[model samples]
Target: MEVYSERQRISNAVEVLKERQLTVGLVPTMGALHEGHLALVRRALDDNDIVVVSVFVNPTQFDNQDDLEKYPRTLKHDVALLEEVDRERILVYAPSVEDIYEGNTISQKFDFDGLEYEMEGKFRSGHFDGVGTIVKRFFEIIKPHKAYFGEKDFQQLQIIKKLVEKNNIPVAIIGCEIYRETNGLAMSSRNVRLKPEYKEVAPFIYKTLLAAKDKFGIESASEVVKWVESQFSKQDLLRLEYFIIADTNTLKPVEEKTNKKSYRAFIAVYADDIRLIDNIALN
Candidate 1:
C-alpha cells in the first residue's frame, strides 16, 4: 500500500489510475483503524478494482475543541492494519490540515434541511456542516466511482446521500452495516477512549437498544423510551442523554409505529465521561 500526504499528489496518482481505466472506491475515515473501519475497506476491495482510504481526523468536524484535541491519531498503526487488507490496489491518503483547506481555509455551510434539526445535529452544533464541508472536498479530491460509510453514523450517512443528491455529485454512496463487538458494543474509534471498567459497561447501550427494539413491537415509542431510560438509570456510570424512536428517512421523533414506514431507536450515553451512540431498527 502507498500513502500520500498531499491532495495534489494523491490527485495526480489517482489520475494515473483513472487513465488505466481502473474503478476507484473510497472509504473516508479518521485515523485509528478498527474492525468497523476495515469492514468498509474490505467491501470496497470486493466492489472496485482500486480502493482509496482517506485518514484525516478533520478539525472542522468537532464541535468541542477539547474533544477534537482528544481524538486519537493512530495513523502508523492504521496503515499497518490496512497493509493486512491488501498490499496492492490500496492507496492511503493521509493529508495534513493545510493540505486539505489550503489558503483562506473557510468552511462551507451545508443545508441538510430538517435532517440536522434533532439528535446529533441538535446536540453538536455545526457538526454536520463540518462533515458536509470535508466530504464535499473529498469527493472533489478523490473522484472515486463509489464511497462507503457505516450505518453506525446513520444520520451522517443520510446527510452524505442528501449532499450528493443536492449537489448532483456523480459517485455512488454505500452504507455498510454497523460492525459490533461480540458483546454487542457498536465499534467506534472513541471506544478506545473509554475508561477500562467503563469499557465493560459500554455494551449496555446496544443491549438496551435491543430491548427497546423488542418493546417497540408491543409498546408505544414513548413507553419504550421510558423503559430504556430506566435501564440506563440502573447503571451508575451510564448517563442516558436522549432516547427516541424516529423515522429513518425524516429523522423526526416518532410517538408510535406506523405500518407503512420504518423507524429506528437512537440512543446516546455518557459512560465515565466518554460519550457513546448507537441505534437499532425498530421495525
Candidate 2:
C-alpha cells in the first residue's frame, strides 16, 4: 500500500489514478482497526476500482479530552489489516492533524436545530459540527465516486447523508450494516475501553433494545421506558443515560399509540465510564 502523509502527494496520487480512469472509493476512519471498520473497507473494495482509507484521529469530534486522549490508536495493526485486504489497490493516508486542517481551523457548524439536540447530540454538544467539518474536508480532498460509513453510527450516518444532500455534494454516500459480536453487542472501537465485567454486561444494551421491540406490542412508550429503566437500575454498574423510542428518521420522541412508518429504540449508558450507544429498528 502507498502511504501518503501530505495533501499534495495524496492529491497527485489521486490525479494519477483518475488519469487511468479508475473509480475511487474512500473509507474515512479514525484509525483503530476493528471488524466493523473492516466491513466498510471490504464494501469499498467490492464497489470501486481504487480504495483509499484515510486514518486521522480527528481531534475536533471528541467533547471530552480524556476520551480523545484514551481513544485507541493501533496504526500498526490497522495498516496490517488493510494490507491484507488488498495491498496493491489500497492507499493509506495517515495524515497529521496539522496537515489535514492546516489554517482552515474554523468548524462547519450546522443548525441541525432540533436534530442536533437529542440522543448522541444531546450528550456530545458540537460533536456533529466537528464531524461535519472533517467529513466535508475529506470529501473535498478525496473527491471519490463513493464513500462508505457504518450503520453502527446510525445518527452519524443520517447527519452525513443530510450534509451531503443539503450541500449538494456529488459523492454517493453508502451505509453498511451494523456489525455485531456473537453476543449481539454492536461492534464499536470504543468497546475496547469497557472493563472486563462491563464487557460481559455490554450485550444487555442490545438485549434491552430487543426486549423493547417485543414489549412495544403490549406496552406504551412510557411503560417501555419504565421497564427498561428498571432493568438498568437493577444493574448498579450500568448507568443509563437515555432510553428513547423515537421516530427513526427525525429522532423526535414518540408518544403512546403514535405509529410511524419506521421506529427505533436508541439507548446510551455508561458502564463504569465507558459509554456505549446502541439502537434497534422496530418496523
Candidate 3:
C-alpha cells in the first residue's frame, strides 16, 4: 500500500484515478486502527474501485488539551493494519497537522440548525466545528465518490449529512454499523487507555444500555434516564456523564415514543479518565 503525507501529492494521485473513471471511497480516521476503523475501510474497499484512508489525529476536535495530548497516534501500526486489509487499493493519507490545517490549526464555525446544541455538542464546545472543518477539508482534497463513517458517533454522522446537503458537496456519506467487542463494549481508540481492571467493567456500559433499551417503551423516557443514572451510580469508577433518549432525526430529547419518528438511547460514561459514548436505536 502506498502512503502520501502531503496534500498536493495525494490530490495528484486521486486526480489520476478520476481520469480513469475510478470510483474512490474515503474513510476519515484519527489513527489508532482498531477493528472498528478497519471495518469502515473494509466496506469501502468492497464498494469502490479505490479506498483512501486518511489517518490524521485532528487537534481541533478535542475540547480538552489533556485529552488531545493523550489521544493515541499509531500511524505505523495503522498502516500495517490497512496493509492487511488491502495492499494495492488502499492509499493511506497520514498527513501532519501542518499538512491538514496549513499552519492554522483553528476550527471553523458551522451552524447545524441546532443539531450541535446537545449531547456531545453540549459537552464539547466547538467540537462539531472541528469535525466539520477537517472532514470538509478531506472532501475537497480527495474528492471521493463516497465517504464512510461509523454510526457510533450518530450525532456527528447526522451533522456531516447536513454539511453535504447545505453545501451541495457531491459525495455520498455512508454511515456504517457500530463495531463492538465480543463482550459488547463499543470499540473506541480511547479503549487503549483503559486500565486492565477498567477494561473488565467497560462492558457494563453496553449492558446498561441494553437494559435501558428493554425498559425504554415500558417506562417513561425520564424514568429510563433515572434508571440509567442509578446503574452508573452503583459503580465506583464508571461515572455517567449524560443519558438521553431522543428522536433520531432532530436529536431533541423525547419524553414519550411516538409512531411519527424513531428514537435512540445515547449515553456517555467516564471509565476513570477515558470517556466512552454509545447509542442504541429504540424503536
Candidate 4:
C-alpha cells in the first residue's frame, strides 16, 4: 500500500479517489497495529470502496506527557501488518505533528453536549477537546464517505457522534465491536506496554466485567460499583479508577431503571501504571 506523509497530499489523493467515484472509508489510528485495528480495516473494506488508515499518534489527545512519550510508534511494523490485511485497497496515512497540525499550535476548545464532564472527561482534562480537534481536522482533510471507530472507546465514539451531529458533517460514524484476546483482555495498543507478569494479571479486568455483567442483571448500579471496587482492591496491581453503570445515550449514572433505554458498564483501571479501559453491555 502507498503511504502519504503530508496532509495536502492525503486530501488530494482522497479527492482523486472521489473523482473515480470511489466511496472512501477512514479508520483513524495511533499506529502499533493489532488485531483490533485490522478488524476495523476489514469492516471498512466491506462497506466502502477504498479504505484510508491514519497512523498518527496525536499529541494533543494525551493529557499526560509521559503517556504520549511512552505511546508506541512502530511505523515499519505497523505498515507490515497492514500489508497483510489488503495492500491494494488500503492507503496508510502516517503523518507527523507538523503534517497534521501544520504548525497551527494553539489551544482549542470543543463541546460534546457535556460529554467531557464525567468519566474520562472528569479524569483527563482537555483530553476530548484534543480528540475533537484532531478528529475534526481528519474529517475536514479526508472527507470520507464513512468513518470507522471501535466501541472500545465508547465515550469517545459518543463524543464524535455528538460532534458530527452538531456540525452537520456529511458522513456516517460507524462504531465497531470491541475486539478481545482469547483470555479476554480488550485488545489495545497500550496492551503492548504491560509488563510480562502484569499482562497475565490483566485479563482479570475482563473477568471482573463478565462477573459484573451477571451481577448487574440482579443487583443495583451502586451495588455493582461497590463490588467492582472491592474486586480491584483485592489485587494490589489493579487500582480501580471508576466503575459505573450508566445510560448508554446520556452517559449519566442510572439509579432508576428505564425499560426502553440501553445501559452499559464502563471500567478503568491502572495495572501498575498501565491504564486499561473496557466496557460491556448490561442490557
- TM-score, candidate 1, is 0.98
Q: Tens digits of per-residue lDDT for model 3 on 1-283?
A: 8999999999999999999999999999999999999999999999999999999889999999999998888889999999998898999998999998888999988988899997999999899999999999999999999999999999999999999998899999999999999999999999989999999999998999999999987888999999999888999989899999999999999966778889999999998889999999998
What tens digits encode model 1's per-residue C-alpha lDDT throughout 78-103? 99999998989899999989999986
Give the winner by lDDT: 3 or 4: 3
lDDT of 4 by residue, 247-280 (tens): 9998988888778999999999998899899999
**TM per prediction:** 0.98, 0.95, 0.98, 0.98
Q: Scored by CA lDDT, what does every candidate get?
A: 0.91, 0.87, 0.94, 0.91
- What candidate 3 gets wrong by more than 4 Å, as runs, is none
How well does model 1 score by local distance difference test? 0.91
Query: What TM-score should be assigned to candidate 3?
Result: 0.98
User: Would you list the clashing residue pairs of candidate 1?
Assistant: none
lDDT tens per residue, model 2, 32-76: 988888889999999999999999888888899899899998888
User: What order do you get sorting by TM-score, best first?
Assistant: 3, 4, 1, 2
Clashes of 4: 0
Give the local distance difference test score of model 3: 0.94
Best by lDDT: 3
